[model samples]
Target chain A: MADTATASATGGSEPAIGRGLKGLLLVALPVFLVGWLIIYPIIAAIVSTLFVEATDGVQFSTASYRFFFSDPYSRANLALTLWTTGVCAVLLLLVGLPIALYLRFSTSRFADLVQSLAIFPMFVPSIILSYALIRTIGPNGTVDILLNAVGLPKIPSPYLTPWGPVIGLVWDNLPLTVLMLTAGLAGISNSAVEAARDVGAGPIRVFWHIILPRMGNSILVTISFTVLGIFSSFTLPYVLGPASPEMMGPFMLRTFNDLYDPLNAKTQAVISFVFCLFFGIFYVWSIARNQRSQSR
Target chain B: MNRREFLAAGSAVAAASALPSLALADDKTIQVYSGSDNNIIDFWNNTIIPAFQKANPGMKVKLVDAGDDNGLRAIADRALAALKSKADPQADVFENFDARLPAGGVEAGLWVTFSAENVPSYGKINRAAIDMPQQLPYRGSQVLLAYDKTKLDPKDAPKTWEQLVAWVKKNPGQFIYNRPDKGGSGGNFVRRAIHEVNGRDPSKFTIANFSADYAEKSLTPAWAVLKDMAPFLYEKGAYTSGNTQSIQLLSQGVVTMVPVWSDQVLQAMSQGVLPETTGLVQLTDLALCGGFSRLTVFSNGANKDAALKLADFLLTSEMQSAVITQIGGFPGVTWDNVAADLREKYKDVVPNSIPTFPGGDWNAAINDGWYRNVATGLARG
Candidate 1:
């Protein structure tokens, strides 16, 4: 690995104009596409959100913000979305960590199968899952049938309530989280583990101190992606939520598209976009900060 | 070649190009704006458009699926705004609901004054329906109360508005309808709530303050009926996805009773969305029929002749029957063909009553500015 690295280092030193152009092409192409398509859309949505107004003709008003904050029901929905996402993230991290560790350390085929199942939900469309879950737990559905067989109370439709969407989001996100977390654990240098064993440290202590720290980048990556996946989502909340859970994304779409009220929808969309913007900036700062350390 | 020969060649080229344009000027295509769904558009393509095509081979007809009621309104708004700014109107045909035509179309001058000159068949449509606000050209169908025959015992079936309410209270969440703000049926339900509530004549409803909100306050009896019946709605007062979802729930036995417009159920049966066992039922005393509206030729279009011919063909007897038998929707234009024979053959598959407006145009659930205010109220609630 060191010799190939040296050869590449030497290769790069050669004064080839085409190689410099190739390097420029490689970096610039991806940057251009990502900026123009993805970043521009995000920026456009944020800008459009600011244009919404109240009937009094108070242009550039914060009436929507006041309305959202004043409504206890809407507040509860926001709190519910946040709480559900946080809980689901923690549960996924806890449950996924051990499975990831086992897959890294164990030779059992069953553990391998568990790894596949853990990641399977990512491939299945979320709407199909919501439909299946609804049918399973909806009144007079399979869950009710089984419960009646055992003399148990029947589960209601939209069984998760404020957290129904969270459950769906977590299920969708777990596969990617497990795959990433497992890869991080598996990438642990064998020499480091052996060195710890040679010293006075035990297996659990060595893992907590070394393996987990080495995995911090992966952990942060998981958190960033899971936050993104759960936030700004609409379909799950739209389908699985109670009659009106009022998630930022779904609420905006319903207001704009269904109700034909672009003003309120744009306002809500803008609020949600601002949150996304802050989160995105934090991610960029983290990546840039890490790059500086690597450069040093 | 000589300069004269070259000049002659150029002249011939220009004439060849100019010939097609002149032919196209006389034989033009009328662009009709429709807020109806693509399925209904497909019904026109398969049934009505062909009938029009057969009659006026000299002209062409174009239908733009404007998407929804607001979509139609927005299209009209754009055209009117353009016209005010001295730009050409894009669509030759203006088709939309009764509520919007008068509010936006006629008031804005995006439409021509209704005269016997363009549409001769205007006389054939029930004069009362023609006098309706913007619904002058056509009368589309809206749903009345309907139920599953297999679930409803014939003797036990609801016959009157009061009896229906009483029966609904006995079975609550099993009753379902689309949200009014969501679809046309929702508006129908809001209007019907008036009849069920106050014993006041529907004619009094055309006056100011007779909005559906009035139905809420004045029609305490109807609300009382609904309050008792609410408990029995599908999934114990849960909403279906929308109209389509409500019907799906009913067909699935997730709900037993739902209100689907006259055409919605028939269209569903055609599309196989619902089973054959489902049947149509309207409350006695012709529960508030929020009739569907249709398209008329715009005065500002490039192809007026072609458009008028197309409009005429669509209203003909052949086209109206084709709409009834093949794709289910209430006929906007009258047809001699849609008489007793077809009704007897199809039985209750079609509505026993094709609701018409004798008491002026069937009053919409709410007029323009009034509806916008009430909508905010519904949302706030």
Candidate 2:
């Protein structure tokens, strides 16, 4: 603080080169750190795959990337990741939005309890949650026993199926979604809500007009997080989903480990990273746009 | 102190502090990269390394956990990376499954070969485990049919792959196997099916140079069998992703029977993840694939001699017996050398020794082929 204050006070007195050098020094360390940790690894992985020599020669080739894109198996894994991400994102919003609204508006003890419940999932480890889901919904599990006691026929375990993963993913992601939405809702001025209410708007009308539009940025963030989380997550899908159409995380893992193909795995990882970057751009844009709007 | 004096004094302290560690790191630590869990590593640290360290003074063995089951792939990746970079490999000793190591690590020329004459414990190792030329054996594992004894009568259990298929057809949704590409137990089952279809010829699959055309042709019968058995599997033939998943199902009594590794089943049973009534059977007419977890000395490692000695120590009857007793895997040494209790425990469960894994590119190709051909419906299902 003292150094910053002294620098600011003497800003005009200092030469332009000195100030410029200080500014560069301030930013250089952070830039280098980010470059070394994030940018360097990603570029190295891409470059390695791109320049990977074929068994015959030392010539650079995109054969690995071509193989990744051309293979039906790789295509299927990408498709599965996208499908699970989209479905889970939509489901999270549908389930989390209403709960967020209730927690935002309601003053009852039940709402407080619900808020605590929403935060509870964030505390549980994903692996433990996966096992819990298996024990709860797997065949002859607690759910099955309860259903049987109620005279309902026992259903097959969903452990190795898509629905199994969808259910587990939603359960895992709900708390985060609700928390983000509630934070967004909390940001909305009470006066705006009250003014709409004073104009004789019903609860639903006030929410539809005032609250929903205000939370657009939050919704976008929530969706972005949901998509990225579901897209890259290894444990939930690995433990719950079937073997064939695995998410990219497990798919890349098997390609590298089970198949012992590092080149192809690197290619797949680069491709998945590219896929995530598309969503990542939108997230960055949303944050920047949100910050701009707030400044205004 | 002034800035100059303070900086100089601090640098001196840091350099002095780092010197001992640097000295210790120089040609002293033998890094053993393995794919076992912390528990297994703990077993090594507590039981094996101390004795080995005492035997060979001025040697330190560091256990680096690569990851589980699939960690051999990481070791291979590291070896490839080291070769590409022209650096000494970080790991001096690598402990991994025989099937997991690609052709003795000989394909990459990354391994130091061990002769029985040099390794005294090699004479005591089981012949089945001695198949790999460059590897020193530690413990062996076979794929076994793990079943809920409460649900399956011991006498009524299927004794062959054909009978197993018949039983699955008879009682639909009560049997399953994991995806061949995901786990070794599942891969073994698929390989066995292919073997049976090719007139029980193991040689066709073990070719060093994997011919895609031959694999496609020879695997036709196996694919057909899988297609037939698919509809009768748990959840209408949706196989679990891994052996653990199938084991979980068997434990929950979700499925009556599933192919599981003997070591995994034993561990699960002792941990109470499997019920007391859970039974293991090595089929009478069919041989499940079995192989040893091996240790190979890296040729480009810093401590090759110490690594070789460590590998040799691992193959001794005492260590092999300890492996069986502690980890619940078969002893790499002859069964006669194993403790009587350990032998009796696994006598009914151990499968006949089979030398069938096509260790080179054939393994990956066959696994991929199975996924593409037989497991096509599973993704959609």
Highest DockQ scorer = 2
Task: Tell me the lDDT of model 1 at A98.
Answer: 84
RMSD of each: 8.5, 4.2
Q: Which portions of model 1 show Cα errors greater than 4 Å?
A: A1-61, A73-155, A159-212, A254-263, B1-27, B32-35, B62-90, B94-108, B127-139, B204-229, B270-273, B285-288, B296-298, B334-337, B343-381
What TM-score would every model get versus the actual structure? 0.72, 0.86
Candidate DockQ values, in order, are: 0.10, 0.58
Checking candidate 2 for backbone clashes, the offending pairs are: none
Task: After the best TM-score superposition of candidate 1, give how far the Cα of residue A18 lies from its true spot, in angstroms.
Answer: 15
User: Please, what is the whole-model Cα lDDT of each candidate in the order they appear?
Assistant: 0.63, 0.80
Give DockQ: model 1.
0.10
- Model 1 gets an lDDT of 0.63
Clash numbers, per candidate: 11, 0
